[model samples]
Target: MRSISEIGEHHLIRRIRERAGDPPSWVTIGIGDDAAVVEPARGELDVITTDCQIEDVHFSRAWMSMREIGAKALAVNISDLAAMAAAPRAATLSLALPPALLVDDFDAMIDGFLDLSRLAKVPLVGGNISRSPGPIVIDVTLIGSARRRRILTRSGGAAGHLLFVTGSLGAAAARIERFEDTNTQGSYERSEGSYERPVFLLNLAREVAANRLASACMDLSDGLADGVSQMATASGTGAVVLSSKVPVDPTATLEHALRGGEDYELLFAVPPRRRRGFEKIAGRSTTVTCVGEMTKAPDLLLDEGPLGGGFAHF
Candidate 1:
């Protein structure tokens, strides 16, 4: 395979731009321009979020393919937008790469990133690329939209709001554990299914936001325990998370479900009066469960003990 140094940066950029296909009509200017120019949402608020995926810190090259890494870099940013019931509009990717990287591998990474972007209908707008002295780095910035007054915020919960989480947790965390265990012995296996492509909760979150079903909301990228505590702290209320109500993955332990981050599910709060309305929207495909409730006091308790920290990057 030809190395990145052989193809040169400008050529790689041109190839990526061509491979990105066409942008939506809303995107007035896409990849070739100095910066992306897009039409504003007619009746909604623009939501923007950025996330980074660094080699080793986020994923080891020994454990995952370049393509999977690229897909994951975008997915995490999309998850942030989905947490607030936002519809993805456009995305920009900045990559820091070593010149020794293979051109085919770079193409594979772009393919993976664009595939998910196409699936989400978020066109790649514009971004920068630079050479890295060490590991590869991928940074994604996603722009999304949500209707005014209908966006979900972490601080919207009240004392009587019922807490709910979408989908089961701990699968990703369990997979990470496996990666760590095997990597210690100088070998690693890619987990079945795209652990890199996490479930996007935009549809469910949009429905809940549109219907005013939830009072507070956030994505569980950092485990259920941290999610609950965050929402409670942001909303200035206490929280009570029932251990029995948490939907743990079949292959994962309860500890993994609670503290193993990267679940990428939605955690939201709905008032007791609107519980039925929320339930009507949640159906079977969504798998939402009432795991807790917001309280008047400021204490955050999971079952009977204090809710601890999770996945801190200190």
Candidate 2:
């Protein structure tokens, strides 16, 4: 297969646009344009989020396939949209590629990403591609929309709201730890199913938003501790997370579940009054679990002590 250098940028861009297929009606303009133009639904507010994945930092080429890497890049951004209970509309992907990267590998990666995009009904609208000096980088910017009254945010929660999370936490972190410890991906391929496609929980988020069930919400990209801290800080409240209540992944430790990050599960707060409604909606999903509650005080505590650290970029 030809390397990116052999195909050149313009031709590669054409191939990408061709693979993206036709844009949906809401997209006034898609790829091959100076910028994307999209029409939002009446009375709906837009929600936008961006996420980046870099080789070595986010994934190792030695273990992760390009397809898995691409799916993960889009999945992370989608998780952000899900946190706001928004329906995805369009996405832009910016890629920084080494000249030596094979065209076939890039195609495979795009296929992986597009597969998820189609599943989510998010069109590939626009983006830029450039040659990188070193490792590959995939960055995605996603745009979504939700009715103003139905949008969820970290600042809306109050001290008396019950804390809940969708799906178990720290499985991704555990997978990473296993990879690091073993230095081989072969033994854990079966377990890595979750790492490839992190749960977005958009449907559940929408239900909570539409029913006004959640007072606050965010995705757990940085683990439960960080999620709790952020939500509490934004809402001008404190949090009391119970270690015993946390639904740890089978292969992960309690610590991993608390601060390992990359879980991509929805973390939300429901007021005591709305508990019944929230529970009714969430009960449809067996993965939902209640971990703790918001507090009037300003400290974030796991049990009786302060919360610990999670994944940090720096």
Model 1 clash tally, residue pairs? 0
Residue 302, candidate 1: Cα error in Å is 1.4
lDDT of 2 by residue, 9-100 (tens): 89888988888898888789888788989888678888899999999898776677777788889999988988998998889999999999
Residue 136 CA error for candidate 2 (Å)?
A: 0.9
Cα lDDT over the full model 2:
0.86
* Tens digits of lDDT, candidate 1, 159-209: 989999887889888888977877654334445544423434777788888
- Whole-model Cα lDDT per candidate? 0.85, 0.86
After best superposition, candidate 2 residue 174: deviation in angstroms?
Answer: 0.7
| Candidate 1 wrongly placed segments (more than 4 Å) | 184-200
Error of 2 at 13 (Å): 1.1
Q: Report how far off residue 52 is in candidate 1 (Å).
A: 0.7
Candidate 1 achieves a global lDDT of 0.85
